[model samples]
Target chain A: MAQGMEIRNLSAWYGSQQVLKEINLPVSPNQVTAIIGPSGCGKSTFVRTLNRLHEIIPGARVSGQVFLGEVDLYAPGVDPVSIRRRIGMVFQKPNPFPTMSIFENAAAGLRLNGVDKRRLAEQVEKSLKLAALWDEVSNRLGQSGAALSGGQQQRLCLARALAVSPEILLMDEPASALDPAATLKIEDLIRELKKEYTIIVVTHNMQQAARVADQTAFFLNGELVEYGPSSEIFTRPKDRRTEDYITGRFG
Target chain B: MLHSYPFRKLLNRAVTVLMLLAVVLALIPLFSILWHTFERGWPAISPTFFTHLPKPVGETGGGIANALAGTGLLILLASSIGVPFGLLVGIYLAEFNPGGLGTVVRFLNDVLTGIPSIVTGMFVYSLLVLTMGGFSALAGGVALGLIMIPTVTRSTEEMLKMVPTSLREASLALGATKTQTILRVVLPAAIPGILTGIMLAVARVAGETAPLLFTAFGNRFWSLRLDQPIAALPLQIFTYAISPYRDWQTQAWGAALVLVTLVLVLNIVARLVFHRDGR
Candidate 1:
């Protein structure tokens, strides 16, 4: 339950071109933190840096300190796969594995870590319920994940991320692709998820951040322009740029 | 103005006729050659021609049975040897080979694919025949497999590479090892394309006479041992086409017809696989 991520002087690069500048921020555990910024502001980059998602991109790299609770994620001898297991992600688009059934999709991460069948099955069930997808899909565990509707696919992705019982869950614009009703459902799911896993979401929708987030960080040009309680950040930001971004003046 | 419109319509008709004539020019010769080949080879196809051996000049008739069986076995052998390597090397190039090594390998594979089939035959002949001291079925198969590898490799790699990168990333992101990802996700997804490549390569190597001429050396009698001399369809055709025997020449046409049929079947199969899996 000691669940806050501390990021100190984080910088990242794609090939040789630096995409994220040095930054400092903290995400409190078991709480929802939203990162809001304009396009190419490194909002996504900052989230990916937490679990070293950028490592998978060839020629892309990070130079930073990311600590979840007591452990420094970027420390030598820390396996990326392990870090990711503890800090899961749901991408912007819902990408349930095309070949996997709903049950298999949720069980994938556990199987990767060599979990046994019974435990994996239980975990998949638990995570799907937690993601609010279990009731709808409980009877159809054998259905292909790709056969789900878009909102359902997003929830399946959430269920997949949750299956490993990760301490942190990173969602990149999880609801942006959803319709209004589905988006509200996701927002509600985020509220419910905050009771368990520490959540960090990046969204272009300021209203989404206002609805689900406890803390909000405004990023601009790879820099953290402001980080404060959502109420203050929305009502009385310290910086003109944060104000501009929040007001939808310009990215 | 209305009368001038008649001249415009005439120009359109003339252009349409010219285009139609051009299409006819392109298609006529292709069909004509096919027709002639069928005409010449059909005469060689009778029950006795299929069952018996090729006869001497001015004699009754015989079959290309030994050659047909030999060709089948040799190709089967070659495919057994080459297909797995093609699949593995292709997976390496598409899924794992990284840095400058992948580029280097891709370039080399392209070069190998471009090399003439006759040269591949000669190369294999030197390595398997002269060095080993005999022309055997095994030698023929290895030579054919070698010829097959690059063609199979390039096509297989291209087919696997065509699978969406997202599919690969999705597997990797699931924490699956590279090998696991390839085995369970990537390869299965590209199965049909890989099969098409294999079929095409098999068909291409089926009628190759140059390699077997040196490697198998064209046995007249049916032989089963890989180390012994072997007969093949292409070699029988090559031998009969050049021989003075009128009987051999006709049997050569018969062998050519069989070879064409085998190639055609392989091609049709490949086409069918592509059609079924294209979506």
Candidate 2:
């Protein structure tokens, strides 16, 4: 069974400047939770903090309790590497290792985790199929990952992350760079992935959030404006800022 | 159609003529050197030129086989000593700490590169040659190695910097350690450029005679030991060119041609290697 994420009083800073203020949210298991906001609203920072990726940047710091199932990820002496292994992330832009072939790109994380070498090919194929890219890339697995088109590259990145079988997947504006057709395909893939892994997506497209998310959280100026069911938040938002944002009013 | 202004057209034609003239003037020395070397040295070319030892001072049927072997050995020694040291320092500057320490080291490297080759020769002559009590191939290799360090270091740093930061993030996000990410991802991406840099550095050092004049001291006999004096191609060419004998001067032209060809071949091979799979 997949596990839920519980974040409490999470705040992040880059040197002296705080980016994400005290934020609290409950992300349920096997569901997609979309965080939507305008530009510079700390949506990206919030997603990065989930798996402790933000702390790697020079001068960046975080203070919070992020619970995965019953385990505190930020507990004393807890390794960020282990936490990241359980929570995989796909960035906003497609970043496949240019030196590696498509199959190698997908197997990178699995190899890092010391997965059985004999099972690597099978695992890579399974992850690519789950990402909806197996048919497109099956014949050209030997080609470099950078040779693929933009949409295909993004899907390959998703496959690379999923090959490790993480319990949760965090996507940061995964489809913002894609065309309309590709965006639709990615939205469909996200829908399918939510059935197995807890998914959190940060997006700028309000229609996309409404269409794919079960729960949505609106953020503004580093603060959590509102969080609730997708239908209630979009159609009957309690906060004026959330309504204005969803209604195309000064987002 | 828009009418062409007569003065503007004349100005454009004049500028074109001037640029063409400048290019031809710049090419004059290159063509002359090639023509001179081929004309004067072609007679010296034979199978024995690559196989036989140099004839005595009064004779004219000798070859520079010992110089060729010595040059190869010298370049090998220089590469072994310099490439690894330069690459490691460059990696540290590019990846580990790019603060005050990196800046100071980079500044020092630049100063080293700017120093005249003869000055470096003098420094090596005073340090290793004087200390070792005599000129040896080891001293020449040390001098060339010193000259190679800055070139390789700068090129390595530049190549490593060209790798995008997103690649690093991608590896780190996959739960890899920093060392793994650098060794597996960053280094592979930078390899082609680093190879090109090393080849260019080798070419620059291969034709250098000033450094070897005081270090190798020009041996006439076939010597393979690194501790003994060795005769290199550039040193042979220099000694022959200075002699009053017409035969010796002709051999200098032949050796010069060989040196230029070696450098040209290295440059072409480096480009081909980079283009083959670096894309």
Candidate 3:
């Protein structure tokens, strides 16, 4: 089952240069939440903080309370490795492991966890189907993941992320590197995935937020300006900054 | 003052021809060495030359079978010691620590690579030969292994660094520990480059004569024991080439040819094996 998340007074910094301010947001379960903003607005950093991926960078720090379904992710006993396993991430670029085959890429997470052969095969097939790439690549599972086209590679990455069966998926500009058709396909996959996962996607494309997200939050200079239902945020933004951003007045 | 399109094109062609000529000039010495070796060495390369040990001075029919076996054994012993030690140090520098101690280790490694091989031989001579009370193949292997360490470590570190940070991040994102990510993803991806480095180190140490002079001490007959002085191709070649006997001089050329061919074959085999597995 999908799990919701609550962020209370979350702030992040890279060597004392604060990139995310005191941001409090509630992410609903089994729904897509889109974090939209201009460049360098801390949208990417915000999602990375949820999965504890932000702290991996040298000198990067986070002072925040992120509750993943009642457990404080930042609590002393909670391990970041376990938190990451429950919250899968997809990056901006399509980074399929070049040394790995298509099937191996999808099964990487499970294999690392020491899953056996028979169950690993079943989970790989299921994940590939979930990512909507099984029909195109089912025959050539032994081929290198890098041999696929840009769109296919992105889908393969998605399959890799989904194979772990995480409750929440964090996508940082997942479709930005893809073409129009590939972007649309990813949008469709996101909408489909919202039924089983709590997805928080950070995107610069506002139209994508409107299409795939159930709720949208607008960020500006590390601050959350406004947030509401996608229709309300896009058409009737409550804050002046949010209105200007969606109306094409300023990014 | 700018030239017209046709004039610039002509200048480009002139520069291309100059580069081609330079390449041919660079290749001349290499081709000349191969031709010279074949010319002087071919007639001496009989079946018995490989199967029989060196005959007494002035004798005509003999082979460098002992030297060939000794060189093989020394390389095997050196690699067994060097490759694993170098690989671990390389992994530490590349993955675990890139600052502090890693910086110091990297600098020392570069300096070690530049140090004279004879100095390495002398150091091993004092440390192993003087302690063991005599020259031995074990001492020679230690000297060669010391020479190989820096080469293998530097190459392995460079190859590991070439693996993109994105791949490491990908593996980590899947909840794999740092050890798992390196062993499974980073190391496997860098295998071809690391193998090339190993082959280069092996080729370099195979032809070394200066280090073995004090360590192995050049045995005249077949000796398989590690504690005994061993015969090697370079040592035999050096001894035979300077002798007054005309027949031994011819055998020296044959031994040189064999040594060169072994290094060449090692490089080719490594390339073929890794090239297939890398993809």
Candidate 4:
């Protein structure tokens, strides 16, 4: 039942330093859209502004019109909390709630939304299964989240996001810190999740974008240079910048 | 390089020897105090030292049991008041960045930590003892609680600041409100450090004789009433140590041993708890 997202004429800044300048894009529902760029390219900031999280910093600001289906996310009286509930996020580093057990970390979002206590066990199990982490973690549900390996912790974070049943999932380089094996696992999980959720991933790995994304958008210096079907974007880019970055000439 | 190498090695050895000497010098007073307390206070220890009330001044065989009970009450009261207040101020400083107000509060807390214990006692005396028309356990606890606030606040702030920002972001990204993120993630992660602070504050105030000198004023009889004046270990030790009676001076040594042991045990327990939590 989730709808596509449409971002129009969006710009963002941290104090006087503009990070994202006049961006427009459309993300289809129930598909993976990968945003690729070098470091400091505003890829993370753009996604953060999508969920109104960029404003949390001391002097960060945004002027944007983001529509999730028919509702303008930045329109008057729109509560950022409510907007975020419908769009969950995962960060570059794996951060499972340090004090919570594996089971509790999965159930945190549900608990916050006042989900029934009796049903939490079932929900947590379902989320872990969806994240492909159940088999590894199910036996030791009471152990602290910190006890997990780096890769397992990232999957646990995925399970936590999925538990909330958000319409959209934003992953900011979810597998960047992981090993190749773990990275493949997350990529496979993303492929599976695209069936039920609209997903946007920000990554520095071109191969990862080629592997996981239905659509690919190339960014450089806070500007979106090209966005198209993954096949076209990789094989035949319209812009020189996109072509140059993709071809390993320069970043 | 060849010419300097031999001289550098000799210098390093000399420095190591000097550091070892410094360490031994620092440890001398610590070991000496422990030895003296154990030697002088050993005979005075008995079952009644912990279980019975203090005897009349000239009588030779009583204990500081009333003072022990009063100390327990005072610590409980002070901690109850100090912990929550300190934790909230620390949260404000760490989380809210309350601008100029936060700077003012931090400066004041540092100043409070520097103030003499007797001065804190006098302030409490003027504020509570004079206003309430008597020295009571409540006034003594208030003075100790005031002393506790600065240490607790500073430690809590430091602990909270140490919590990684990623955890807060993770919580917020999951649609948790700011308050929920802080309560569910930040505070829980910082618990070990905050608890260490609280334990240290409690230990710091436990041996304070000057603060209780004019506030609790000292009582001979067993009194549990918070409003009434109460006896405490430090007050009992100080009173007896200054008395002409040799038996009372002996009792003071016993009380000092008990007090030091209690504080040492508490610190050990706190360290154990924090270590376990950290893992």
Against the native chain B, what TM-score does each candidate's chain B reach? Answer: 0.88, 0.94, 0.95, 0.97
Best by TM-score: 4
TM-score between candidate 1 chain A and the true chain A: 0.97
How high is each candidate's interface RMSD, in Å?
Answer: 2.3, 1.1, 1.1, 0.8
Give the per-residue lDDT digits (tens) of candidate 3, residues B1-279. Answer: 999999999999999999999999999999999888878888789999998999997667999999999999999888988899899999999898567888899999999999999999999999999999999999999999999999999989999998988888778888888888998899989999899889989999999999999999889899978999999999999999999888998999999899989988988977886677666
Order of the predicted models by TM-score, top scorer first: 4, 3, 2, 1
Q: How far does residue A77 in candidate 2 sit from its true spot (Å)?
A: 2.4
On DockQ, the candidate that comes out on top is 4
In model 1, which runs have C-alpha deviations exceeding 4 angstroms?
A135-143, B1-26, B46-61, B244-247, B275-277
Residue A113 of candidate 2: its Cα lDDT? 79
Predicted complex 4: CAPRI docking category? high
* lDDT tens per residue, model 1, A1-251: 73889999889999888888898998888889999999999999888888787777788888879998889989999887667768778888888876679998898788888898888889999999998999999999999888899999999999988888888889999988889998998999999989888999999999999999999999999899999999999999999999988888996
Model 3 ranges with Cα > 4 A deviation: B1-13, B273-279
- Candidate 3 structure, TM-score to reference: 0.95
Residue-pair clash count for candidate 3? 0
Q: Number of clashes in model 1?
A: 2
C-alpha TM-score for every candidate: 0.89, 0.94, 0.95, 0.97
Off by over 4 Å in 4: B1-3
* DockQ preference between candidates 3 and 4, better one: 4
Selected candidate, larger TM-score, 2 vs 3: 3
The local distance difference test score of model 1 is 0.85
Q: Cα deviation of B130 in candidate 4 (Å)?
A: 0.8
User: Which scores better on DockQ, 1 or 3?
Assistant: 3
Residue-level lDDT tens digits of model 4 in B55-141: 887777888889999999999989988898999999999998787999999999999999999999999999999999999999999
Please provide, for model 3 over A169-194, each residue's C-alpha lDDT reduced to its tens digit, 9 standing for 90 to 100: 99999999999999999999999999
